[model samples]
Structures are given as C-alpha cells and as structure tokens.
Target: MNILFIEDDMIESMKFQRTLSKIASRHTIIEAKNGEQAIDALKNSESLPDIILLDLNMPRMSGIEFLQILKADEQYKYIPTIILTTSENRADLLECYRIGIAGYVIKPLKYEDYEQKLTAVLAYWQTNELVKA
Candidate 1:
C-alpha cells in the first residue's frame, strides 16, 4: 500500500516513519511537510496513494482545509483519509467526520501506544479493498 503522510513537525515525522517502518514494511510512504505540499504530491504523483495519514495542525494549511479541497475534487474524494493527529478536540473530530475522513486516531504520548494504534489502523485498511483508480 502507498500512504501520503502529511505533517509539519520534523521530529514527529521521523518518529512516524520509524514506527511505520517497523509495522508496515511493505507499504510505501510519501512525506509532505504541509497541506500545500501534500496537494502538490497528489497532483504530480504517477499513482494516487491508497490512504492518507494527515495531521490537523500544519504550517501553510490545516488538515481540515486540505480535506475540504480534496473531498471537493472528483478524482481525490474517494481515497481514504485518516486523521493521525495529536489533537483530541471534539470540534476537530466532528469536522473531520463531517468532511469524510475514514478514521480519526489520536497520537498517543507513548511510543509503544502510538505504534500499536498505527499497527491496528494499517491492519484494518490492509484487509479492505480500495478503489484502484
């Protein structure tokens, strides 16, 4: 599977990469520093990602803004987007659901907990059939 991981924090991004490498070695991950960069990656990529792991807080554009733009577009709307954020805000959760996110996962403070959550998420998605286009 291919995943587009959008995050602004370098340390968090590195941590995620390390954890993901341990869990889903077969999956390919593409990194984007912000929502704008994520959009550019989508536009320029030869193939769209199977899923997107998005962070809510980013420098240029927030995750909600990115989702709004993505879900509005016909070509990208069907791709599964999951919120992998540190925020547990009710409003953020509600808005992400309203915008059509596949799942909302809070980034756990502990490395082990974070890895477990990511493992579960990946396992679930790996079993589901995704739109090839």
Candidate 2:
C-alpha cells in the first residue's frame, strides 16, 4: 500500500513510522510536513497515493483547508483520506466527515493502543479495493 502521511511533528511522525515498520514494512509512505507540502508532493508524484493519512493541525494550511482543496480538484478528489489527529473535538470529527474524509482516528496516548489502531487502519485499507488514479 502506498500512503501519503501528512504530519508536522517529527516525534509523532517517528512514532508512527516505528509502529508501521513493526506492522507492515512492505507498504511505502510519502511524508509531507504540511498541507502545502502535501499538495506539492501529490502534484509531483509519478503515481498518486493509495490513501492519505492527514494531521488536522499544522502550519501554513490546516487539514480542513487541505481537504477542501483536495476534494475540489478533479484529479485528487477520489483519493481516500483518513484523518489521523490528536484532536478529540467533536466539531473536528463532524467537520472532517462533512468534508468527506474516509475516516477519523484520534491518536491514543498509549503507544500500544496507538499501534493497535494504526495496525487495524492499515490492514483494512491494504485489503480493500482501491481505485487507481
């Protein structure tokens, strides 16, 4: 599975990477620090990502803004984007769903719990049939 992981925090990114390596090393990840960077990555990619894992908060452009842009664009609108965020706010969840996010995952405090959630997310997406760009 090809994943585009848009996260600004280095530590959080590292933790997710570690968990992913343990769960599925065969999957490839494209890292983007912010919404702007993510847009650039998508524009330049030889092939689009199978799924997008986005952080809700970041510098420059927020995930909601990014989602608006992504969904508006014809070429990128079909990609399944999951919100992988620390924010547990109900408003955020509702807004993400309104903006047509595939899923919203709150980052658990416990490392073990985080790993479990991530593992399940990855497993489901990896096995699901994804339409090519």
TM-score of each: 0.95, 0.96
Error of 1 at 17 (Å): 1.3
Q: Write one digit per residue (lDDT tens) for candidate 1, span 1-133.
A: 8999999999888888788778735888899999999999999999999999999999889999999999999999999999999898999999999999999999989989988999999888887877343
Which model scores highest in TM-score? Answer: 2
How does model 1 score by TM-score?
A: 0.95
RMSD of each: 1.4, 1.4
Candidate 1 segments exceeding 4 Å error: 131-133
Residue range 85-128, candidate 2, lDDT tens digits:
99999999999999889999999999999999999998888778
